[model samples]
Target chain A: MIEVKHLTKKYGDLVAVNDLNFKVEKGHIWGLLGPNAAGKTTTMRILTGYLPATDGQATVADFDVFEQPNDVKKVIGYLPESVPLYPEMTVTEYLGFVADIKQIPKAKKREAIEKTIVTSGLRSVRGRLIKNISRGYRQRVGIAQALIHDPRILILDEPTTGLDPAQIIEIRELIKSLKGERTIILSTHILAEVTQTCDGAVIINDGFLMASGSLEELTASFAVKKAGVHIRLRSASAEASALFKNMAGVKDVRPQDGGFTIEWSPGADLRDDVTRLVVEKDMGLLEMRPLGMNIEDLYLKIISGGMPQ
Target chain B: MKNIWAVFKKETKCYFTSPVAYVVIFVFLILTGFFFHSLISWFNTQSMQMAQNPYYMQQININQMVYSPLFHNISIILLLVIPLLTMRLLAEEKKIKTDELLYTSPISVLQIILGKYLAALFVLFVMLALTGVYSLFTFAYGNPELPAILCGYLGLFLMGAAFMGVGLFFSSLTENQIVAAVLTFGSLLLFWILNWAAFSAGAFWKDTLNYLSFFQHFDDLTRGILDTSDLVYYASFAFFGLFLTHSVLQSRRWR
Candidate 1:
């Protein structure tokens, strides 16, 4: 639903987004992952047609962001980073205003606003002024405004930022529930959020595209370098560490509390071999589990230029 | 068109919800009332004294003595009050980050500028309408020339709208509403005094300064003279102000 090619945005001598390329397929939730000031918001702004790019092109729902900005805007709903809102308006009033600006027909405007109020779980606070609401409710109102038009694509910048833990969980579930219905581009620096909510992720650092792929693919690619397993045995023995180090695929073995951790060579599945050796050697095998690389590890590896081959 | 209306409705609603609209109207009514009452008392005393002399009675026309100065004073009051009405139109949007919502929407920048400008004009219209009660008082007690009064009001409305457009443009240029208001007031004050330069400057400079003074064109309207050139000047002034606002909004995309 969205394609960005060689997107470069420069401010005087500073480059905000440089040579970035990525694609988000329809009905998939993609995370634009990056740290603060990593140009994530700038990229989203360019995609939403709010800001013009210095070079390259982007298209949303088959409309070029620059050439057909109105069309692009029609198909996309954007929630800016700060959750822009009119404090004097009520939740229902604000949503109605957004519905009007989004060009929802007058006959269906009430229904659209009511539906969005229900969807964003804002019915309870629909009559309250926005300035009087809590941060969590304000965030919900922001999401409600974005969803009032029911556009095909939703672009949210840091949707869960400034929320309590409970509110964060609720919002995460809300986003996850929206997974298959629309194309979502959620930007955040939270690694766990991407792991928990996105089908694919595009990692960026210092305005450069560090990596982009499915979550599994990215984890698998990074796993090639530091793949390992942790085994907890009933008995700790120096002999077991020596025996494991001598194994063909085993690269190193480190003794830990009550057991040993093993690192293996790339493209090696030493689980079965290690299991058999542990059982046969009577080392009292208690627990054996493969350690898959999480997004934190993958992010660190990519940012530090240790990209998988 | 619908987008503009939507924005217009929201903006107009916002003006009432906040205290700005009430305070502006209240202050305006009090000032205009004080001016109207004093002018009427002075006119009554002068006319009573002139009643003794038949020659002077014909020269003391109520329209000249009352409506002309009334409308002119209202116009000057509008000059001071318009910036307050327009300062928050665009500057507050930028300060609160709501410009993202506006710019990213499907609406064109021209529509946004027109919608906001029209909303400020609407507020000015309401304020003027309330002041009409004072005009009704004049008609009730004495004979004030209806055509001159109407023409004076039309002139004030147009000039006020032109000044509002300029204030809206200044609001778009800054994120601080105070700065926007002060700059708009300062610029309007400069134009108010531009005619004074005509006395010191020679030839070309005098004509240029006189032409730039808003009150020069407005004076023609107050005298019940419907000059097409004066109408064009007010219309063009408002158009240029809105045009500059549109350009400012468009430049933000590039920035």
Candidate 2:
């Protein structure tokens, strides 16, 4: 539903987003994952046609962001990072204003506002001024404003940033409930949010694409590139460590608390040989463990080792 | 057109629901009423003296002595209070960041500007309409020239709109409402006093300053002369201000 290619946004001497490329499929919630100042907000703004990119192309629902901004704006709903809302306006009134601006027909404007109020879980505070509502409800009001026109695409920037833990969970559930028929690009620094809510993610750092794939694919790709295999020993000795290090097809060994962790070259298996040597020498090998790449592991590996080849 | 209406409705609703509209209107009426009472008292005092002489009595027409000067006073009051009406129009939206919602919506920038400009203009209309009671009082108590009073109203309304347009541009230029108000007041004051600078200038510079001065264009209308030049000047001035606001918003998006 959305595609951004070579998107670079520069502000005079500073480049906010550089050579960024990512795609989001229909009906999938994709996280734009990055740390602070990663150009996630800038990228989202560009996609929503709220900001013009310095160079490169971005499209929403087949409309060029640069050439056909209004068309792009029509297809995508944007929740800016601050969750901008008119605090003086009540929830329903705000939604009605959004519906009007989004060009919802007068006949269906009320219906659209009603549906958005429900979808954003803003029913209870619908009559209250946004300023009087809690941050959670205000956030809901912001989302409701974005969803008022029922656009197919939603670009939400840090939708859960300022909420309490319980409120965060509520927002996450709300996002999860918006699962079907909406292509969502939710940006966040929170890694766990992606694991729980996003089907996949385009990970960027310092305006550069670090990795972009489903969870399994991202970890799997990193696993292949970093090392093919790792063996863990509950108890081991210096002799055992030397044996694993010199063993054919073994890459390196890292000794930890009463244990030794071993990694082997890509497409190699030295587990059998290492096991036989430890048994013959009667070295203390309490247990054997295989290292599986999780998200945290992949992220650390990328940060420590630089970009994957 | 629909988008403009949508924006207009939202803005007008904001004004009505808040105390700002009532407070501004109330304050404006009090000031104008004070000015009217004092000017009319002076006019009455002068009329008694002029009553003894035919030529002086003819020189002391109500339109010249009261309504015309009242129109000028109202325009001056408008110059002060219009910033209050317009400072928050775009500046408050930018300060609160609700402008993001408007910018990302399907509505064009031109529509947003027009809708907001018209909303302030509507409040100006309300302010002017309430002052009509003063004219009715004159009609009931004295035989003032009705056409001149009506023409003076037209002049004040158009000039107030022109003030709103300038105020809207300044509002668009800043996110601070105070800054917008100050900038608008300063700019309007500069334009209002341009005619003073024209006094010492040669023919070419004097004519340029006179044409550029906002009150200069308002002069004909207050004289009960509905010249197309005055109408076009006010209309174009309002349009130009909105046009400048549009340009500011569009360029700000790129940044």
Residue pairs whose backbone atoms clash in candidate 2: none
Off by over 4 Å in 1: A225-227, A231-251, A256-259, A264-292, A304-309
- After superposing candidate 2 on the true structure, give the runs of residues whose Cα lies further than 4 Å from its correct spot: A224-292, A301-305, B253-255
Poorest lDDT segment (10 consecutive residues) of candidate 1 chain A: A300-309
Q: Residues B84-194, candidate 2, lDDT per residue (tens digit)?
A: 999999999989888888889998999999899888989999999999989887888789888877888998998888889999999999999999999999999999889
Local accuracy of candidate 2 as per-residue lDDT tens digits, A178-205? 8799899899988899999999988887
Q: Worst lDDT window (10 residues) for model 2 chain A?
A: A224-233
lDDT of candidate 1 over B150-217, digit per residue (tens):
88888999999899889999999999999999999999989988999899999999999998899899
> Positional deviation of A196 in candidate 1, in angstroms?
1.3
Q: Once model 1 is optimally superposed onto the true structure by TM-score, how far is the C-alpha of residue B3 displaced, in angstroms?
A: 1.2
DockQ of every predicted complex: 0.77, 0.65
